[model samples]
Target: VQAGQRLLIEGAAGNVGRKLIQLATAAGVTVVTTSSARDFDQCQRLGSQACYDYQSGFGDQLVRDEWTFDHVIDTSGRVALATNLDLLLLGGEVTLITAPKDDQFTFGVRAFYMAQKRINGFVISHATVDQLARAAEVLNQAFSAGQLLDDQVSQQHFSDAPRCHQWLEDGQDGHQRFVLLPD
Candidate 1:
C-alpha cells in the first residue's frame, strides 16, 4: 500500500483486521474499515481513518458517498464479494484471507476485465517459512514501535474454546480478543 492510497478492510475488529489497520497506517496508507458498532472505537484506536458499522449496511453508505478503494482486504469474507469489488477503483485489487463461509462468490466478468481488477486468495497456513519470517520481522518492528497492543488480548481457560468460537461467530465479543490458554 503506497502513501495516500485508500484501503478498505472488512472485519476490522477481528485479530487479523486490526493488524492490517496498524500495518497499513504505518505504511502511510489511508484506511477505511468496517466493523460492528460495538467495535467501532477499537477500529479507530487501531489507526483506521474511518470506521463504518457493517451491520448497518456500510456498503450502502459507500455507494451513496461514491467512495472507492485502491485495495480491499477481507478478513471475514462475510460481505457480498461483488459489493466489495464494485467499490474498487480501476486496477484495484481485492485480497481474501478467509474463504467465504458459503463457499460461493460471484462477480461481473465484463466489469472485472474492463477495470483490470485483481483478486487474490491468501492462505497464511500455506506461507513458506521465509515468508513467515519476513512477516514476523515486520510485526516485530510494529511491536517495537508500540503499534501492536498485546494488552487488549484476554486469556480464557482452554475448556472455553467452544464458547469462544461461538462468541466470535455470533459477534458477541467486540473490541476484546480472547486467547485460549491450554490447561
Candidate 2:
C-alpha cells in the first residue's frame, strides 16, 4: 500500500480485514471498507475513512460517489468479487483470501482487459511454512506497535469452544472475537 493511495477492504470487521485497515492507515493509505452498519463505528475507530454496508451494494454506491480505488483486499469472496472488479481503477488489482463457494465466477472479459484489472487468490493452507512464519512476524510487530486491533476480546474456558463456534454460526457476535482459554 503506497502512501496516499486508496484501498478498499471487504469484510472489514473480520480479523484480516481489520488488520489491513490498521496497516494501511499507518502506511498513509486512504482506507475504505465494507462492513455491517452495526460495525461501522468500530471500523472507523480502526482508521477506515468510510464504512459501507456490504449488503447494500457498496461498490455501486462508491461508483456513484465517484470514488476509485488502487487496490482491494477481499476476505468475503463469494458475495464480493464481482462488485470488487467493478470498483477498480485502471491497472488496479484485487486480492482474495477465500474462494467463492460455487467454484464458478463470471465477468466481462472485455471490461477486464480494457481496465487492465487483475485478481489474485491466496490460500493460507497452501502457503509454505516460511511464508507463514513471515506473516506471523509481521502481524506480531503490528500488534506490538498498537497498529492491530485488540477490541472486544472475549474469553471462555476451553470447554466452551463448541458454544463459541455456535455463537459465530448464529452471528451473535458482530465484530467481536472469542478466545478459548486453556482448561
Candidate 3:
C-alpha cells in the first residue's frame, strides 16, 4: 500500500491484521477493518480509521457508508472473492494471506477482468531473501518505535505448544497473538 491510499483489512483484530494496521498506517495509508464488535476499539487504537463488526454484514455496511478501498488485505478466508471485488475501486486488488476454510470459491470472471482488478495469493515462504530482508528492516524500525505493542501478545514456553495450539484451534476467546519462547 502507498501513501494517501485506503486499505481494507478483514479480520483486523487478529495477529496479521493488527500488524498490517501498524505498518500500513505508519506508511501513511488509511486503514479500515472488519472484525468482531469487541475488537472495534482495539482496532481503532491500533490505527484503523474505521472498524466494522464482521458478524453484522460488514459488506453491506461499507456499501451503505459509500466506502471504497484502493486495496484489501484479507487475513481470514471468510469473505468471498466476488464480495471483495465489489468493494474495490477500479484497478484495485485483493490479496489473500490464508488458505480458505472452504475448498472452493467462485466469482464473476467477466467483472473481475473488466475492472482491471487483480487477486493474489500471499505466502511468506515464497518471498526471496532480499524481499524478506527489506520487510525485516521495516518491522525492526516499527518495533523500535514501539508501534508494535506487546499487550496483544501472549507468550508461552515452547513446551506448551500443544496446549496453545489446541486453545487456538478451539477458537480461544480473544484475538491476542501467540509467541512461543524457548523453554
Candidate 4:
C-alpha cells in the first residue's frame, strides 16, 4: 500500500492524471496536482490535497510551502523539471512519463546528480499485461466504490473520427472525454 505517501501528479486534468488521481486517492496517498485554474475544483474533487495552475508564476513558492512529496510524477514535460526535483524529500523518487528535452533534460540530470535523487523514466506502452490487468482491477474497484468520476464519453461513428478529433481540437466538448463508436 502506498498509503500516507505524498504524491505530486503534474497535468492532473489529462487522462493519465485523472486516473492517477483516483488510484492514488484509493491507495490513501495524499496527492498534489497541477493544472489550469479552471480545473482546480475538478482536481480537488478528484481528491487532490492541493491544486495549482502551472501557468501562474513559477509555482516554486507553493511547492516549497507544501511538504515535500514521497513521489513526483511528471506527465507534462513543459513544466519546470528542476522545480519538481526540489519538491521531493531526500530519498524520494521521481518518475518522468514524458521526459523533458534539451536544456530541461540537462538541468534535470544535473539536479539529480547534485541531490542524490532517484529518477526513473516510464513509458505507459511498456507496462506488462499483468501490470495493466492489475491497474484495470484497481479502476474497476474504484468505479464500483464511486471514487472515480464518470467523464462523459461522446461516441461518434468510426467514420466521424476526424470530426471528433476536430471537436477536441476546437475544445467544443469542454472537459468531457470522447471515444469512437462502432457503427
The TM-score leader among the candidates is 3
Q: Counting only residues 3 or more apart in sequence or on different chains, how many pairs clash (N, Cα, C under 3 Å) in candidate 4?
A: 0
Between 1 and 4, whose TM-score is larger? 1
**Which segments of candidate 2 are over 4 A away from where they belong?**
none
On lDDT, who's better, 1 or 2? 1
What are the per-model numbers of colliding residue pairs?
A: 0, 0, 0, 0
lDDT per prediction?
A: 0.87, 0.85, 0.88, 0.80
TM-score (C-alpha) between model 4 and the true structure = 0.84
What tens digits encode model 3's per-residue C-alpha lDDT throughout 48-132?
A: 9999988888899999999998999899899887778899988999999998777687888898889899998899999999999
Show the lowest summed lDDT stretch of 10 residues, model 1: 145-154
For model 2 the local lDDT of residue 126 reads 90
**How well is each residue in 123-151 modelled by candidate 1, as lDDT tens digits?**
98899999999999998898888877744
lDDT of 4 by residue, 58-174 (tens): 356565576688888888877666677778776788888886753434345665677677878888799999999998888788878886665777777899888888888998877
Per-residue lDDT over 41-159 for candidate 2, one digit per residue giving the tens place of the 0 to 100 score: 98899899988899888878899888789898888874646777888899988888887665777888899899999888889889999999988988888878876757788999999
User: Native-vs-model 1 lDDT?
Assistant: 0.87
lDDT of 2 at 14: 84
lDDT of 3: 0.88
TM-score of each: 0.86, 0.88, 0.89, 0.84
lDDT of 4 at 151: 78
lDDT of 2 at 57: 82
